[model samples]
Target: MKQKISLITTGGTIASKETKNGMLSSGALSGDELAALCKLPDDIEIRIVDFMKVPSMHMNFHRMLALRDAINKELEDPDVTGVVVTHGTDSLEETAYFLDIVTEDKRPIVVTGSQRSPQEVGTDVYSNLRNSIYAAANPLLENGGVVVVFNERIYSAKYVKKVHASNLQGFESFGYGYLGIIDNDVVSIYQKPLHREFFSVQNEIPRVDIIKCHTGADGLFIDASVAVGAKGIILEGVGRGQVTPQMVSSIQKALDSGTNIVITTSAEEGKVHPAYDYEGSAFDLKERGVILGADYDSKKARIKLAVLLACKNKIKSSDFKY
Candidate 1:
């Protein structure tokens, strides 16, 4: 029997076109239009769903959940081997992680996007989309949670990040590296995540904000987030998750007001550990009721924090350990 794959297009550079003004208009093509331009595999069967046509920046909690539902709906058919989602590269990692956490199926959920529009020279649109379809149909990727296929490389949604603005190799999994690569339409596996996590999003995703810590930085952002009724805050601290002394007061204030605050490192590698006892050190913040964010970046931490807040049970520091 031929493998069946579900291809859902949500609009991104892969579907974008060059506008009359010479700027790229994102998501200009429908799903069928984009697929028609690509040379898809003849051995496999593909099902297309033109889910949405918008830039990645326009993706919000409602749409993310809706996308998850759409994927779940497609998976109801046992004949479907896996799924591929075309997205914008700008916020691709965030949406990938969001799907990783909430998607209920073990079959591969491969998310992909191109850095250049289809009309551009030396474009990666065709190759990336074609490779993603193969990756989605491959059984080796099953039970691995969500994965992002870009520049012929497959990345775990948990660690992938958009590292470049316009390069074809726009996504990377620093420290851990990519899970695998797709070469010549064949998918190869190098490794897989040791574990996958899922959370039931029973409530509306709450307001989670990320505040970056810099030299002489204060708690203005934290204060603003709390005033606006943010349920969680992620502190993108520097070097082992140390914030400026000035931001400590506002962090404590947010914690006192029952806002979930997590401290994450700005470094590409290394988890936030409480090694020092300074005023704004990880140890100090941990003692003051801040959860260590491990190695997650600010955007990823924000997504997980929001999902956890929306899920059942009281949130705990142990919840972010994975």
Candidate 2:
């Protein structure tokens, strides 16, 4: 029997080509172009879902919701073994992490992107896409949430971060490292993400804002975010998730305004711990109703907070079971 796979195409460097003016991210490639590039095995039956062909920075909650729905739709077909999403590297990690929390564990879902456009030399598009196919087709993570495949490394979406500005090794799984690796000639698995929590899609996804805490942040962004109907806020703070004194007041105001606040470390690799006792310390923030983001980065924390706020009554901290 053929290995049935559903491939979703959302434009990125993978589907880009050089134009006279500049490298364009558009419908430069899709089904046929990928088929030609990967030359997938004869026994693998690939079905393409051309959702969008735009850069990843343009990916928002609405588009991500649509993508989520698309993946769910594909899983409805018992014949489809797994799903693969080709996305832009810019916001790919955020999207993957979002999908990880909301997508019910059913079938494998692999997301991959390239650092360089296909028109550029040393492009990793075809290689990453091919390896992603290998991951989706195999049963490695069949009882899945979401995984990011790049530079032959397989990372759990929950922990993956795009660490480098421009490199084939753009991704890092932080403390967890990669779950596995894959190449054209080989496939390997060392570990897998052990937990997943899902939420029901809401009619309207809530607005959540992220503010990076800096030395002189005066809480303007926090007040502005709350003013703009933000249901939640994520504060990427300094060491051990400490914010400036000025930010603490605005954060308290946000919490009083019924907005959920989550604190994360801007450092990228460690968990948010309540160690400091100063005015803007995690201890102070937590006492003021801010939630600790644990090991989650700011982007992923925003995703979690949004989903939780979207389904407020239905989910609890225990639901995440962190």
Output the number of the TM-score-best candidate: 1
- Candidate 1, lDDT over the whole model: 0.94
What is candidate 1's CA lDDT for residue 195? Answer: 87
Write one digit per residue (lDDT tens) for candidate 2, span 1-322: 8889999998887888778887575546775675577656566899988888787888999999999998989989999999999999989999998888788857899999888887677888878988888899888677657999999999988888888988889988767788888866477888876666887868578898889988788899999999999988889897788999988788888888888888888886677788978899989887887888877788888888888888764433343346
Clashes of each: 0, 0
Compose the digit string of candidate 1's lDDT tens values, residues 1-322: 8999999999989999888999988998999999999999998999999999999999999999999999999999999999999999999999999999999799999999999999889999999999999999999999999999999999999999999998888989899999999999889999999989998787989999989999999999999999999999999999999999999999999999999999999999999999999999999999999999999999999999999999853678898889
Clashing pairs in 2: none
Q: Estimate each model's TM-score.
A: 0.99, 0.94
Which ranges in model 1 have alpha carbons more than 4 Å from their true place? Answer: none
What is candidate 1's TM-score against the reference?
0.99
How well does candidate 1 score on lDDT at residue 67? 97
